[model samples]
Target: MAATAPKSLGAGEGAGNIGFDRSGIAGESKGLLKVLDTARKVAKSDSSVLITGESGTGKELIARAIHRNSTRRNGPMVIINCGAIPSELLESELFGHEKGAFTGAHRSRTGRFEIADNGSLFLDEIGDMSSDLQVKLLRAIQERKFERVGGTQTIAVDIRVISATNKDLAAAIKEGEFREDLYYRLNVIPIHILPLRERRDDIFPLTDYFQNNLLDRSTDYQIKQFSDQAKQVLTHYEWPGNIRELENMVERISVLVEEVDIQVHDLPECMITPSSHHTSSSVSSVFNNGIGFNEAVDQYQRSLISHALNESGWVKARAAEMLKMNRTTLVEKLKKMHIKPEMETPIF
Candidate 1:
């Protein structure tokens, strides 16, 4: 059953108590807030949940949040990466095996399902689960009971199932790679997390969170401020790796950058340089505008100068250095072009 949308909680609010501990997940963007709200509402239920998102988008983090907020908070939260384990051993990994059930079974082993009893079982990368195993998993999840590998006695357990996957299971089902029935059983409450690029509003907040949080733990690390130009670059670039990439970059800079004021040049070259897609789109717009050649060149110069000036906080000398031009020359051009901060647009 679908849950009604409730008022979204601000990031870091309603924390510490059960069903409200959103300690690690940070972001105030509407997309993220909505997801969190749904997660909170679903946490109170015992229905199965399926979380879908790109890699590094914090699907597991959401799963954990749901578990922490749920009735089973005190129970163990067992997780398994379906894609990481081999198909041959995955069944045993999920359902446990008796001694001598398989060649490697030196002794009877408890699987994730059994270990997760009375708690939450997070099946990560569920899309990658083998077709052969899908049938067994569906039955177990449906009945809340299963026989251990090579064991005749059936074992029963109470668990809340939460599965996450980066792949599109709808297409997988159409292609017969994933079972449709199993998909329905697991997707009772679907929660999709938008990628970082789609929620650009969270970038700076996350940066601040990562920077300050890291500094608290390590004496070697220090908080670094992001320059306006650097912020611009971060805002425009697509974060294919999502929150994980942002956190890593923050830590990397905190360790390596000695300057307290982080300049645009301090950022990774990939972020500073325009991607082929963006470059092509910008160039196409320029050509489509049908402006004269000289005017086009002048506009291009204005964009560059404006970008540099903004990056340098309107300091002529610094902007000139960034542009590899004399301060006098840059000032003269700015006056001639009638450029102002408000008119500045980042072409890259």
Candidate 2:
């Protein structure tokens, strides 16, 4: 047996160019497209962007996309996870410290903000930052100046800030856990990515991509395909962990499923018979609770519209025709249903 060569992306498929095909973004879902569009547009400026989404939705990847497309693309893009570091040490991590500032501060070291000067600073898990630190961060961001953890001399930085979080900052603010003032400061341009369950169209492409990329990286692993029934299980399953979970699932199957093909039985129990917390169970509950006719009609309409849009590849005009409704009527339905991207997609 021999390893297969990696399949290169077609022309203009890479990120920050024609589309967001780069960085494992792999998908054609409406939500994915809207996310890329927003990120690329904001990348041109030095605005502070706050990205919101469920964990494992690729927030860091989106941040990198923005930094790569920005004017400071050539400069370094420093990233720091606020939640990962302890409160006692996070200050030094962000602002650096001078010698003898703290017990472990043996010598002066540059912090993420200073390192990202004239570049981009990505603050992941901003929601988890301590309130006291948030105040300091706010001051530094507002003044573009900061005194390192131990140093008294102020250092000025010319950098763009991109922050992301899975926690609900609004709710945190109300709960007195997160600062509202800092929230406004960081949220100049807000971008949100829907969960994987809502964008079922992406699951297949992502599966294909993970398998192909994995094969390229691991010669011992042979190329693999998902059976139709397995694919159905994948798309129907509610991906509570979102994109990261899907990627992991593909990697797991590729590594452990000895066969070249993956069948329904190979899928995890979560995908086959989803649990009560899963959306599949929720759908069942919708019927079991004895819903009214009007509520049933609304639910069916939402599902119908979603199916049409997804079937037409989110070409609103085409989806409208498929549903035998005018474009404007479809638009209203989409709005009421909270559908993504108001405008109709242009033909490819």
Best by lDDT: 1
Model 2 agreement with the true structure over 128-183: per-residue lDDT tens digits: 99998999999999989999987899999999999999999999999999989999
Instruction: For model 1, state the Cα shift of residue 241 in Å.
Output: 0.6
TM-score of each: 0.79, 0.77
Q: Summarize candidate 1's per-residue lDDT along 83-146 as a digit string, tens digits.
A: 9999989999999999999887889989899999999999999999989999999999999999
By TM-score, how accurate is candidate 1? 0.79
Q: Global CA lDDT of candidate 2, please? A: 0.78
Assess each prediction's global lDDT (C-alpha) against the native. 0.82, 0.78
Off by over 4 Å in 1: 1-19, 215-222, 279-348
